[model samples]
Target: MNAPAYAHPQATHTVPLGGARVAYLLVRSRRRSIGLEVGASGLTIRAPLRVSVAQIESALQEKAQWVLDKLAASALRVQQTPQVDWGQGAQLPYLGGLLTLQLHPAAPRGCELLAVGEGRWVLHVPLPVDALPASVRGQVHAWWLRHARLLLTQRLQRFAPDLGVQWRSLRLTNARTRWGSAKHDGGIMLNWRLLHFRLPVLDYVVVHELSHLRVMDHSPRFWAVVASVCPDYTRLRAELRQQPIPEWDL
Candidate 1:
């Protein structure tokens, strides 16, 4: 189950795992087992309220290798992911390419959506040349979110019919741990950050979610459904996993 947005870690602990020392936030909940999650925010541990600290550390030791490897990978991803510059000539990712930002403070009062050429998209922001980066980032982010809805919806429509499924709705998500998810009722939630990748990668995610509508689980049958529409799903999936998305501080 998803935790409440206001929930916070109860405590923090440092433990020796594998050959490294790791620090993790501990959240005591009513759950039956201890759960360890590593994401953009580092490591978090969720354990039952009745569990002892020793038991929790023991579990951490049992998964020492896995935890260490994931933490190291997360660090590497952080180092490789570029932070958006949010400047007049800053470049942004779009459709597997980059879009150069052009600030036009005196030109107009809002953003101008322009498509010049292939991989030559330009976002004209109506902000001063010396405007704060937060302001610039907000405008650009708003534009990307709006554009992602249209693009993702179109892609979903393009592949859903071919896959013999009709998505009830398309919901853009900002989830950190998943690219997309499909509900039994055909509601599709796709991460808007996927706009950073190429068209094929976005299409693969769309197809993957649609396939889940036909087969709820990732069994062989579900993979077959995905392969039907995306014969190169394996490669595209890998590309999506291996590629690093730009980190937006906004």
Candidate 2:
């Protein structure tokens, strides 16, 4: 069942949490109780249509400490994550290593990767020094997308057979929160941003989704399937969560 448009109303309000004032979006619907969610953008409160604003504020007051702690943590994460610099000498992650960007307007009109020496790699772009940052970012993004599709397709084919499952399709996703998703029809959706991590970490996400084809839920058996292929899946999973992604959006 779904709530009608009139049954759910949304508004923003500021409430006193502890001694500090914090703002949150309030969404009222025909739900059973009030729900509080703290995310990157901040707090959001979902309350039943029958709940009054005063009551909602009172509930928020009860969880003031929790809200403040989450906000502080979110702020810290934002502060620690570095934004990507789109220019010469900037580096991007590639197969667990850093690939430095080098602009050479006279070299060529496309992007090329050259191994310098001693495990050093450079991505050569044919763009002028005065080129806009957005232009550089756009070209790099376009190259990455094309590379991601081809590389990911090969990886899926390699892993599916070993895992005794036949994947029908592979779709690269730009999802914000999830790394991958599996459908009962053998369709797998993997975030293209996984290219930023090491090969082992990316393999963990691939194996995790393929395991879901055999077992739909996260049961003990499902975990066993994942562990059989990746004995260090727990560590790889942590790396995926802790690794800071370069600011992809220009």
In terms of TM-score, which candidate is strongest? 1
Q: RMSD of each candidate?
A: 6.3, 7.6
Query: Candidate 1, which segments miss by more than 4 Å at Cα?
Result: 1-16, 21-67, 106-110
Task: Report the Cα lDDT for residue 18, model 2.
Answer: 73
Name the runs in model 2 displaced over 4 angstroms. 1-74
Q: How far off is residue 149 in model 2, in Å?
A: 1.3
Q: Which lDDT tens digits does candidate 1 get at residues 74-168?
A: 77887999888888899877888888889877655557767888777888898888889999999888878888998998898899889998899
Q: What would the per-residue lDDT of candidate 2 be over residues 128-188, giving only the tens digit for each residue?
A: 7667889888878887888888888888887888789988998889865568999999999
Q: Candidates' lDDT values, in order?
A: 0.83, 0.80
- After TM-score superposition, the amount by which residue 46's alpha carbon in candidate 2 deviates from its true location, in angstroms, is 14
Check candidate 2 and list the clashing pairs. none
What TM-score does candidate 1 get on C-alpha atoms? Answer: 0.78
Q: What TM-score, over all chains together, does every model reach?
A: 0.78, 0.73
Where is model 1 poorest over a 10-residue stretch in terms of lDDT? 2-11
